[model samples]
Target: MARKIPFFIQIILIPLLIAAILLVELKHPFPKFRLAALVLVFALIVDVAILARGKTRNLMVVLASLVFGLSLAEGAAGAITPRSVVKIDRGWSVRQPIMGWGPEKAGTYHAQMIDPSDNSIIYETNYTFDSDLLRHTVSADSGPAIVFFGDSFTFGDGVKNEETLPQDFADLTGGKQHVLNLALTGYSPQQFLHEMETSRFDKVIGPDPKLFVFLTAAWHAERTSCKAYWTAHAPLYALEDGRVVFKGDCNEGASLWWREWLGNSALYSYLIEPWRHKVKHNDVELYVSVLEAAVKMAKEKYGAPTIIPYLRMPKEYLQGTGFTNDSIMQRLSDSGAIVIDASLQKEEAAGAQISIRIDGHPTPYANRVRAAQIKAAIDEKLPGVLLADAK
Candidate 1:
């Protein structure tokens, strides 16, 4: 019989090989590393059976058991996470290669809103997307309007149609100001430019809007560089020669198998998306470029005054997120767009009045507060735009 390999070698060599394989898998772009890991695991098993003996064998067995237990614990945690429980099919989104995903269908869906703080306090509500794939409007269709463009905050994720920022703005003006909400959920500045280029506003709401309001949040910069999952399939653009150039749909060059696989994996999303954000190229330039394009479009197409209301986050959160209060304000000002200072929302958020307890979205009260600030800014800037058709 062959002499068994020493226990120390079995424990040290096997674990080192496994660790090396994992490190390579994590750092390398090749998919074959997974196969290598599997092969290494199998080889480790066979080697242990043949070579490990007594105390060494016992240690290897304990290590393997611990790894198995941790994996089970991880899977269980992922299974019961808040994200898993709130998987209602709202049917509000359609897959668009240009925008990655967009509001294509119109319907009201009874949805469950999960509070990120505590998932147990769930709220069931009706969410509606109009025929134009924008948030349902409350104000009447007549009179000059202010066009609102943004993502979920502007789309009113956890609030009713009447409680959205745009709707609240309309209400503050006492129905004299028509607010055309062109905002869509998960939208970025890139999509805003696309909407302008396609003349979606003209086709959906008639002549260009009197004023353009671009609501921006800190996450918009990170989202602009996201190319995995839904964003991987959406249309991508880049700034070329100081102009925005369409780079076509991401799915055209991406692997369908990889795309579909990663899109459905919660593990991949939970682990990889954040990692990508930290390691990927800085997206601030892309975001600023898109904003510049949008400002130019608003000026040239409709000669409308573009207002950028940057919904501020906590100061600590803004520090390393590629967006500073000063940098964003300066950029928009340089683009000839008026910038709304972050002071109002900053105070509201600090006082815990700007967001809901569970859902983390702007509450009705928060929207009302924000709308009031926006109206004040408009009144200060344009003087009589909000009071144009007052009774």
Candidate 2:
């Protein structure tokens, strides 16, 4: 007792179902399971269309079966996948006028970090930020404080509070020195200069810092110009007439609807980020200029000896690429900043197993190793800056 459905309706349904499956495949985070489900769904839909034999009742049953199957598949996927929880304590960060975003809240952020390579759960940890949005102390209240500024490496991305470079340095010095960490995750040379210009380093830290250190990696150069996930919401800068110039904010005049929908997708980011970096390849000059500006500010305002420590790329990745950190280091050295080449240290670290397997950030051992190298370099190069028995 069922009416026959038209052939045209079945034809339309087939293409629509395939298109729907394709869209899901593109957006789904779990590709393996999603692809399997897609294939199954496609096969089922085709079989249902053929078996329906133009019966309306069969078509309705097919629709119901498809809906039920998809719901079950989604539920299964959800049950197996671990959820990522990120809690940002009050006063952690606020939107800035030109910088787009900065740390404003002074509390701890707890989250389960996931490895992007395999989508595996890495670890759950807490990240604490001070009133100035700094992970370390605002200033050395007692004794001469050493200040460090840079991106996530300096921010101690994968490590705990005590495992950071500054903390290790403080511990190595027997806790006699104050180590100020002004580093922000995803910071470029531009943000470092901007923070120096705006932050209350003198009032908060009190007295002049004995040393100022700037840490960077080759990837940071691309961050200066690319609108990737890390730098997309940050302030833009350009080098004009041999001076650092603020261009504007990246999130300015953008619609939140599209950003919230597409920008949050990891797949979207994975695809678009590389394209953005490729298009904005001429950022080397901007990076160099920003470094010069930071060193100039440190020397002029704080009279602190500036040390720029850069992480070396892996030898395998460095091959066939014209990219080198030497030119940047040389430029910073020319501007009176002592450069610490971490290439040799990186090789040594490989032998020591000092980095995480899933997440490639430096481990606690690696941080300690870097700290030791930095202390040695300071003792050898700057002489009286560090204590004689600090190591």
Candidate with maximal lDDT: 1
For model 2, how many clashes?
4
What would the per-residue lDDT of candidate 2 be over residues 1-391, giving only the tens digit for each residue?
8887676776677766677666665565563445344455656466465646558657856675775665565555555554443334444456655455567767787645676557676756678877666785432347666888777777777778888877887787777667788776677777777766765456655576788888777667676764455565666778778788877654445544455445544444445545655423256667677788889988787778888877766544333444456766787889999888754464564687566665566777777877777787788898878645554
Provide the lowest-lDDT 10-residue window in model 2: 82-91
The true-versus-predicted C-alpha distance at residue 333 of model 1, in Å, is 1.3
How well is each residue in 1-391 modelled by candidate 1, as lDDT tens digits?
A: 9897787877787788778767755664453334344445555655675576788878767766655554454455456544543544656677754466765578886657655655564556666777777677777576667888888788887677788889998898877767788887777787788777777567665564678888886567666655434566554678788677877654454465566645544455566655665412246667777788889988898778888887655566456556676787798889999888633655664775667665677788878877887888887887756656642
Query: What local distance difference test score does each model get?
Result: 0.69, 0.67
TM-score of 1: 0.74
Model 1 Cα shift for residue 121 (angstroms): 3.5
Worst 10-residue stretch by lDDT in candidate 1? Answer: 29-38
> Which residue segments of model 2 deviate by more than 4 Å?
1-99, 114-121, 137-140, 255-262, 265-267, 279-281, 314-323, 344-350, 387-391
Inter-residue clash pairs, candidate 2: 91-105, 91-106, 92-105, 139-205
